[model samples]
Target chain A: MLLDKFQSMAGVRAELEAIGIVPFGAVTEKITSATEGVVNGHQVILAGTNNYLGMSFDTRCIASAQAAAETWGTGTTGSRMANGTFAEHIALEQELAQFYGVDQAIVFTTGYAATQGMCATLAGPGDVILLDADSHASIYAGAQLSGAEIIRFKHSDTNDLEKRLRRLGDRTGNTLIVVEGIYSMLGDVAPLKEIAELKRRYGGYLLVDEAHSMGVLGEHGRGAAEAAGVEDDVDFIAGTFSKSLGATGGFCVSRHALLEAIRFSVRSYIFTASATPGVIASVRTALKIITAEPQRRERLWENAQLLYTGLKQLGLAVGPSVSPVVAVTIEDRVEALQSWQKLLEAGVYVNLVVPPASPSEKSMLRCSVSAAHSPEQIDHIIAAFAAVNAARPVGIPVA
Target chain B: MPNYNIYVDYIYTVLRTIKQDVEFTENTDLVTELGLSSLQVMELIEHIEDHFDISISLNILPDINTVGDLARKLQELNG
Candidate 1:
């Protein structure tokens, strides 16, 4: 059955490769120089990554990781549901809870696991999971596993949302409306306060995932919910340290005591080992930097604005992004592939997205600006996009 | 109870923001008049679920041809 499934999807890998995405995590994984990624021995800029904060190389984080690795050895060797809870793990969870200003926090080995696990635990059968159509695959997977009837809301349209709710009546009691603080693809934000207002009036919980927005948005880096002034109104906050934190783990923090119960019941939580010592240490250090050094976030935004304004000025179809994630939406898939190659040839690397990752028949050349980037680097990024824009009048549609 | 009034209000907001022009009471084809692609229609339904705090099945999604048709469907769900 496994081989049959493989055979059925045999075209997927080759198909993706033909489009330039290639077996991304699989390829280019060979040991290369740290400062630049070598793809076929060509040094390429990594604009596709969600590393908005660039704390992956923070010396203090590295030191903390090394220190934790030396102290705790390697892996936890057990799940948090069992003997996996080390003092460091407990301390990290406590610190994260305090950081988010929530009563309890549970750490998962990956952000994907956290989103799926917490969604599954929080929503149930006969309940509703209203999601954004543009939500990440992790959110969709969580909603699917949660046994709730999945409902999709138009991306950022609060009015279409109210109509869908009126259609549900008393069933609203069991609903969990899911949204993200900053959407990974187009880098757009949800209308959180309005969503929260509906959730409050209609009797449901709001679960906001700040996976991409953590350390990148809001005053204290609390994310889009804080930006919208709906922090306390959100029932659960889910995020991962992978993107901005440059670590590998996920977390769910909530004011509900019920969240603590999910720790015992969720299989994904029960069976999986907790985050490694190094990861926890790095995240702890990363969180401190995210809060203490607001300059990183500011610089990241400045870079984003530079790139965005530059591309627009030079006549490119850049997205209406409010964050560091700027998307260049193209209409045709093959054309997107060609544009990706062009940008690469121009010395910048970006994410090449096609449907169903892209919405509304849209393909995107996704570029993420980072705090690690220099202004010259930002200008180079702009120049690269400008070159691509000038060279091609592609078949991208205006919606 | 002005349930139709609520439907018109919702439609007004959607049209103003997403579409731009539409008559409330006449035959208003959801896809054509609202200019909603299939993907956007799906998103619209999801937004309705969140807005009303209720669950709607993708299966029950109506071929919304007129403003009255959408209003009637909303009444059925609200019932």
Candidate 2:
């Protein structure tokens, strides 16, 4: 009798799950031999994960994780500030600072925590926090929590940003500019140099979240800020170890020592339990491998360029994406879901981004490529898309 | 930009950003005509807030439906 809200949720859940785009709790590793799933009793290629560098199964990282887990047991069991602080965490922070060529680096339990914590701590009641309209939800939540007058500029529109900044005038005292290094859905990168210059002029702190671009972009795998040659121009560079590094954790690095002040102020860091030793060990190994293995970055770019070129040659709309994450836009949500189901059925898995996730009218198929995928596997994926996309929708296809 | 309806253009951009229909008229309801969910409509408010640099009251937004309605409100706020 009192199940109306739950019933509505159940309906939405049923619709989503029926289409193969299983939400969190319902995710069936239908192909579990490799990453845990039981899909028709056989292992399936996992292409949807944000595993850009494919370092998850690397020998060194695995070995390091094993060692740390064995040595430190299971969990940290406390926050970083109190009983949770470990030598490994400090070492990782130092390594991340050196890696980013920044003077300061503060680690957090998650990339989301890093973004939210830093933004929330830095911005104040009267301050303006302007961000790209397409920024991640974490950034939005952080802005909300910061009590800052949040502003949104058109995605990647420098002139629009200038207009917003101009309006703020001398009130720019505590203005904080935030943008993502690589957008999650579209995979398009931000114009960091243009934005950094704007920040420089406006006299505000600039923060770049490299959650999607951590090891995917930049020659040194530093991120968009480094790639855009604005590493120095940017005031803060926050990143996740989840993507290219193939681990779980986040860090915020900066040229100014003031960013360290946020450690005492940010609640997300002080409240949550610290990251496990295993993640730190593996992330360190992965970061080293990321910097040393230029070949991985090259191969990743090769795979991305191949897929993008191949998709474009097929005469389908593939991106606004300039990175390894390629998105094919579909105007209809049902059509998008159908395409995703077909891809899963064919053993080529990708992320299904509908309505709320997409910052545009079209739902998107977000395919993330990695260095681990061979030329043949890459070709097979493209061929599959070609066949699948061509067969469906005689009048209109998802792409 | 010539002969273009700036109001409709702006509305289309905002609606498309939130994955709603681009169709709108003077009497169309912002929530009903476009079928905007509560979340998306809030996002629309955020878009308007940034574009205009003026915070809108919750009550004033509920009566808005079409691009004309929103544009007129924006003009009033600016004035």
Candidate 3:
């Protein structure tokens, strides 16, 4: 019975193999640039990776990582609560707090941990968590682990959320409302202004996960809350250094004084080894770069618009807006799989989302634009989609 | 507290709106018999919550099996 799940998984894998493609995990042989890579031996434009600012290959970040590795050795080898709390770890936390203009911040091993830890630790038994149905897996995992009563509101629907809040009534005071700045699958922005208004009328703490939106939205790139001008109303912000920061770590910044106390209670922070000295160094440098460079965000948006418009002009079904994440919806799974493979062959790489992973029954080819993507690269990516569409088997409806 | 039978009848009525073709009864398994996906199950919970003016924690889902079980849980919560 324990192995039955694996058997079911094997059946799924067999079906995928029969189709000659398993889009879930394709190996990248080499990363030639921030926007290009050799994937499965085919040279392709990297349109799926969430390297928004493309700080991964920055000379300053690389130099800092190298210097940190040389000075502090490699890994921290212990959890932050134990022997892992280095001076640099504390400094990075302080820097993140400053970046968000918050009084407290805590760092985690990965973005998943940061979001999950906050979700799990922020509320416990007898408390309630109201989250978007389309929230990331980390949020779900954390909510389930928290021993809290969990409720899912319809995705980005302020009316649905308000109705739930009304139903909560007195219990609304103990509820934690969780939403993402930019949804990962379809790249839709949350209606934070309306949600903040609801929170003001109906009492609840708000936590915005800005993993994808950090350094990609707002004048200073704080996230959707800042862009929406409800920063004061937002209780907490959870984000990742892995996206725009181009390093491997996550953080939670809050103006609440309880955040420092929460640091000791989060199992994810206390149980896992701290980030490597090299990663911390690179992330610190990347944070500075994000604050200094507004051009990167502009370039990223330009590339996003170019890809989104080009795809739309090709008569493809794209997301509602021109977010850095452009998802092409295809109703038929077989056609989606075939199109994904064709795009790869045409020297473009994008994510293939289907089934439960997708928000709905439709499969999507999710493309994420990066600041490092040149206009030519964006055009080529769009061209690959066009070619794939043109070559679709006759009688298959255009997505 | 409301009569337990009233809860059962109301649940069957709600279930029909979601799956009009399915034959329903108190003993019909909500998951296996109706073949409700996770999303559908959540929808069912939301609808029931709205109609009854109650908050149903997803944590209680594991213990609920048949239509009757859900009604019983509703009674317990409201009681």
Ranking by TM-score: 3, 2, 1
Cα TM-score per model: 0.82, 0.86, 0.96
DockQ of the candidate models in sequence = 0.28, 0.14, 0.60
Q: What does candidate 3's lDDT look like per residue over A1-399, in tens digits?
A: 778869977988899889778687899999988888898778999999999999989999999999999999999999998999999999999999998898899999999999999999999998999999999999999999999999888899998899889988899889999999999999999999999999999999999999999999999999899999999999999999888899888999999999999999999999999999999999999999989999999999999999999988888888999999999999998888888889999999999998778888689999999999999999999888878887766622456
Cand. 3 TM to true fold = 0.96
lDDT of 1 by residue, A287-335 (tens): 8888899998898898888888887676667777556888888877767
Ranking by lDDT: 3, 2, 1
Clashing pairs in 3: none
- What's the lDDT for all of these models? 0.78, 0.79, 0.91
Interface RMSD of each: 3.7, 5.5, 1.6
Error of 3 at A9 (Å): 1.2
For model 2, how does the per-residue alpha-carbon lDDT over A1-399 read when each residue is reduced to its tens digit? 777659977888888777556633425445332222444332456666778888888989989999999998778999998888888999999999999887789999999999998998888787878888888989988988888777777789998788778877897767898999999887888998888888888888889999998888788988898899988888888888888888888889988988778788889999999999999999999999999988998988898898888877777678865578888888888887777777667767778887677887678877888888888777877877787778865723634
Model 2 CA lDDT for position A399: 47
* Top DockQ prediction, candidate number: 3
> Which scores higher on DockQ, 1 or 3?
3
Q: What is the Cα root-mean-square deviation between model 2 and the actual structure?
A: 4.8
Stretches of candidate 1 off by over 4 Å are A1-9, A12-26, A29-35, A393-399, B1-55, B58-79
Where in model 3 is the C-alpha error above 4 Å? Answer: A394-399, B1-20
Model 1: lDDT of residue A75: 88
